[model samples]
Target: MSDFLVVGGGVIGMMTTLQLADAGHSVTLLERGRCGREASWAGGGIVSPLYPWRYTAPISRLSGWSEGYYPELALRLYEETGVDPEYRQKGLLYLRVEDEARAMAWAREVGKPLERVSADFLYAKEPEVAPGCQEALWMPTLGSIRNPRLTRALHARLSAMQGVTLREECEVRGFRQAGGRVTAVETSQGPVAADQVLVCGGAWAAALLEEVGITLPVRPVKGQMILFKAPPGLVNRVVLMDGRYVIPRADGRVLAGSTLEDAGFDKTVSGEARESLWASATRIVPALADCLVEHHWAGLRPGSPDGVPFIGAVPGLENLHVNAGHYRNGLVLAPAATRLMVDELLGRAPILDPAPYALEGRLAGGL
Candidate 1:
């Protein structure tokens, strides 16, 4: 029996598994499909939330903690695996805001380095921006990473670590319980006994827990993205207009996305969404209108009812914990979330207050 069994092979599960294994625990991670090929692979890789001011306090806490930890983690990953996740401090520019006052106030409250720039200043900074965007907010401390690359690096690093086993193509069918504790997990291959179990199944978490009479409020939120191949230095930094964004990678590839749709588990990319995203991209950065659209794809984000992820022990179930429901911020929040989960599992002092993210705590509150 392994000391820990992590269900789901996304960024959250992989990070949690790595942390546990590094802490001298026997860990096995099970994934229905190939690891990290889900939402973690399809995200824009923005290290900060799209609209930081709009999210609740708990969300901010996780994002803040992660923003500080990702650079060091990326460096370590590169040193160990020789795989660069392309963690970049490119910053974020919000092109339009309905409540600029509120945004500025929130930035000040959070001690974020935010500056209001006029249209002329924005154009001087990023000449490719569309002409009509007259004002913007510049967040200098925000960063991004190549999500797919980061996931690959994590998988490789975890595989090389001692006492870590990754089981891809191993779909967890159900759980075996004894006296309200999940003692073992039944997989398609076979039953694996575990001292503890963590369900980080992303969008499928709710359905997985339902078999045990637990209803977690998480669902699949489909988001589609389009990729554009442009010359290097085309879009200087991440640009945001409303909720949609355009992220420029170091290799001259720009990612423009996405549409939040309640489309269940269907990840089909629609023509409507493609055109909409293309329009948004061109509208934000006029130069993108000329760039060749390489391809488009979609992923399912684990949408939560309260927008705050559940990251603690399961009520009434011993040796069973949860670390899912991160919605759209999984990549940005992965590092800190993993630390918090491992801290709880090891009975150590938590790095942050656990009340806001408690499984059964009140849904409304902030840090």
Candidate 2:
């Protein structure tokens, strides 16, 4: 029996397991399918939440902590696993500012650098942007990471660790509890004993916890993305307008996305969504109208009631914990969330105020 069993293989689950193992805990991670191919892989890899000011205070704090930690973590992953997640500070450009005053106020409140650029400056920085996009707010410290590569690196690093076991295609059917503690997890293969269990099942997390009588309030939020194969340096930075974004990858692929729908675990790519995303992309950067559509796909983000993920011990269950319901900011919030979970599980002083993300507090009508 391992000391810990992490259910779900998304970036959060993988990173949590890796940290536990690094701290000398015997950790085993179970994934229903291949790890990291879910929302973690489908995301645009932006390290910060788009328009961070729009989110709640908890999200802002977690994102701020992660923003500073990602570069060091990315470098360490490359050094250990020889896989660069391509973490880069390409900056994020908000092409249209509907509430400029509010955005400026939030930026100043958070101490984030926000600069207003004129049409000439915007054109000089990105010539492909449509002429209609005359002004923008540039956040120069924004960054992105190739999420798939980062997940792979974490998988590899965990596999190389001594006490970490990764079981792909091993679905946890249910849990076996004794008294108030979870004793073991029943999987398709067999039962695996665990001293503690963490449910990081992403979109499927709610159903899993429901079986144990825990109402996680997590639902699947479907987001569709369209990929365009363009020349390198076509879109130099991440461009955002009306909550839709065009992210430039290191491999010369421009990713334009996405549409958030409460489609109940349905990850279908619709023609209408494609048209809308393509139109949005072309509207922001007119030159992208000529780029070939490389791929169209959808992923299920774990949506919570208030956009804050539940990241503490489960009430009424002593040994069971949760770190799911990240909604759209899983990639951006992974590092800080992982740290918080580690601190909570190890009984150490939390780096940030844990009350904002506590599961018990959320259950008791706390934000």
Candidate 3:
């Protein structure tokens, strides 16, 4: 069995570690703070390819495959760790106000049971939705998982694994690379050696890689989201309108998000952003206007120049790999990215092609 060290404890890192451990490899996960408390927890939990029709074929395939995996994975994790991931298949509704022809054509090509619903029909289905809103595309294939529960479930399951060790509150200072291979990692506690190292730090990857003379063109894209305490049946499906979304949680909380900002490590929840999100939520669903604000949070998505995740081995280092830069879709893309990373490490064919998201492609594109 191989002894592998995975840096970062977000969803990507946790999923990667679980995959490696399942493959009979010894995996150690090091987290700088509370595991999964970063972007993975902060995401809106919209489990789609994000503009599914616009994503490259390979990226779309990865997301589609991962979406199929969530149901079974959720069950297995819940059974193993006794922690429910809160996987929900409530579906996604995308409001289309412009480019109706293009939207219909693209929907036809994807063949995901897309249907144009009238405003009255939408209101009939989701009574809480605002009547002023126009038509929307009903995408029934979409689903979501409670991100925080998934992270906690993964962490618990990995902790129970015989070959997996999770070192929480351990901040990685730098890497020790020699002969083009990362030999060990320097952390706050001390040095830990492993046969292979995987850098899965989310928004903080670029900074971490810079310490080792490698520059990952990953930047922090801040997203601000707000939550409202609504009834469980307040909104039956995920609704997207005016470039904002309202996702209904299983626990009677409605998630309204988000503002994309190019802020670096600044996770402050701004009042203006919150107000804008609240306004958008109210516009989409008038009932949210009367709902009480439960919480608000901001997270930095690790955005790559091309807006695709960085998977597979890092260049100039054979045993060192990268699985970061997932941006806004980290939670949605975690399973597939982890599966591909494990497959590559084991010299097996990946679940999906890694070319589009390879580190070399990022360099060639001048990102």
lDDT of 2 by residue, 211-269 (tens): 78987888899999999999998899998988888999888899998998988978889
Q: How many clashes (backbone N, Cα, C below 3 Å) per candidate?
A: 0, 0, 0
lDDT, candidates in the order shown: 0.90, 0.90, 0.86
Tens-place lDDT digits, model 1, residues 258-336:
9999889999999999999999999999889999999999999998987788899888888888988899899988988
Model 1: clashing residue pairs? none
Query: Whole-model lDDT, candidate 3?
Result: 0.86
Q: What lDDT, from 0 to 1, does candidate 1 have? A: 0.90
TM-score of each: 0.97, 0.98, 0.96
Candidate 2's TM-score? 0.98
> What TM-score, to 2 decimals, does candidate 3 have?
0.96
CA displacement after TM-score superposition, residue 305 of candidate 2 (Å)? 1.1
